[model samples]
Target: MMLRPFSKSGSFYKGNLHGHSSNSDGKFSVSEVIDAYKKRGYDFTCISDHLWIDNRFCAETVTDASKYNTHNFIAINSAELHTRGKKYDKENLWHLVANGLSKDFKPSNDEENIQDLIKRAKGDGAFISIAHPEWYSLTFDEAIMLKDCHSVEIYNHASTVKCNRGSGIYIADFLLNENVKTLLTSTDDSHSLEEDAYGGWVFVKTKELNEKKILKSLIKGDYYSSTGVVIYEVKLEKRLLKLKFSSSNNIMVSGAGHTNISSHGYNLTNAELDLENFDSPFFRITISNQFGKYAWTNPYWFNELDLD
Candidate 1:
């Protein structure tokens, strides 16, 4: 069965899940950060500053969600937890984005390991996302060992801005190939709007725009990640998957066991795939524009539906 987020009809709300402010290492304050995204026509934003004790205690200050919400815009309660490996190195940092955290949630002290931190976050009722595996050079073995991770970052705006190594599609694809059941997400992770902001975001389909609704949609994988492209609809019927999307230079369908199909041309807006002949365990759509920007849909697993 197709997930309710894509199968259900509703308004699409755009928002950035990862971003920083002066509360951590960002250049702007919390209010200014909210305004920056609001003026850019975003419907919601999560002020996920680095979760440290010194400067960024977002959990303490990010109370009163309505204070930052505008007429239609919303501010979600979140934070980015930075966990370091027991053996430090260039790739030792593991950044995890936690959304919809409870008010009493507390960050693990320096003595805690990455697994412990993730467990604590989940216990506090927050959605956990493994952030920028590629940038961290996270191996397939390392990624597959992560526990209770709801999603992985396919694209990270800040990592790209600072260093060109941000995309984590390979890691996500590897996990999916192992039947690890996780969603994909992209985020601006923006430290500076001029350089890193607006380059990544997630489009959530929800009946209404509010903190509870948006968080629920995210947890349910009722969303898609994008840099520029927009998908209007994704429909599955009689073993055929069809997509309606904005213009693109190419559209691709990819899955396990070398299952791949692509259409290349200008102004390509729609495509259809016949799953009757597809033997892959799952499949997903990716669209890329001439400018190299891309949009991605969550994978659809064959075992989840009664294909027989």
Candidate 2:
């Protein structure tokens, strides 16, 4: 069988899984955020504004962009959920992104913790994720604690452009190293209408353009995250992993604790790597385009994939 997104039978929907609007710290309003993404050829965008009961960097309610759903493009209900008790955060908040949330979802009260918030979000069937670990210096202990999350923001656009610290690769690697079994995601996390808006997104392999379908797909890891590069296909045939992607300067296979193999050249379109000799229990692909853009594949586990 095929691996995840490539294995799934569906159309690829281009969407930004994390973003902000004036409902929180973002510069644009909900309607404008939708319009901005739509004008830039996006199939969907989330208004995942900061949701917390505070005056500095959060709103009391999740920003609802559901009204902007057109037949072709759509919006998923989401928020950059926050709670207290984190180390090294200026605001002492733990940022989590909960997608496919209802309008009735409540923000964290003074008494509850991150686990409390995650429990509620999971109870509602929401897709939970750790947000921007690098930006806020999320530690290994904290990541292990948020084990309930489905994913971590492998890339945060605003965090990178603003402070030059937008990577969660270290946190993600730490999780994988611990056998946490989490997926990877990339987000714009756009709080402004500037270069932060279109920098990162996901191509979800969903059957239709419906919000529920998209969110379900995400939970199943039926997607690939990117920052401009594209993965056309990934398939395994007799222990040889084949990848078809956009023109790139490098195609690398990386795994647990620095195990990696790479191919580099000018505008290389595809690669055939032997996995039989690959030693890691899991492996992921990363492609770097000539312009320095990167696309990431969710890590694939060997035993779980049932390679026969």
The candidate that achieves the highest lDDT relative to the unseen native structure = 2
- Model 1: per-residue lDDT, tens digit, 1-308? 34445676788899999888777777887888899999999999887877744443333333334578866999888888866672233535567898888755665556788888888888777778888787778777778767369899999998887899789888888888888888899998888778989999999998999888888888888899999999877777777777778888888888885788877889888877677777788888899988888999988787775654
RMSD of 1: 2.4
Off by over 4 Å in 1: 1-4, 53-66, 86-91, 306-308
- Model 1's alpha-carbon lDDT is 0.80
Worst 10 residues of 1 by lDDT: 55-64
C-alpha lDDT values of all predictions: 0.80, 0.90
Model 1 per-residue lDDT at 246: 87
> Against the true structure, candidate 2 has what lDDT?
0.90
Q: Estimate the TM-score for candidate 1.
A: 0.91
Clashes per prediction?
0, 0
Give me the candidate number with maximum TM-score: 2
Residue-level lDDT of model 2, residues 110-189, one tens digit each, is 79998988999999888998999999889898999998899999999999899988999999888888888899999999
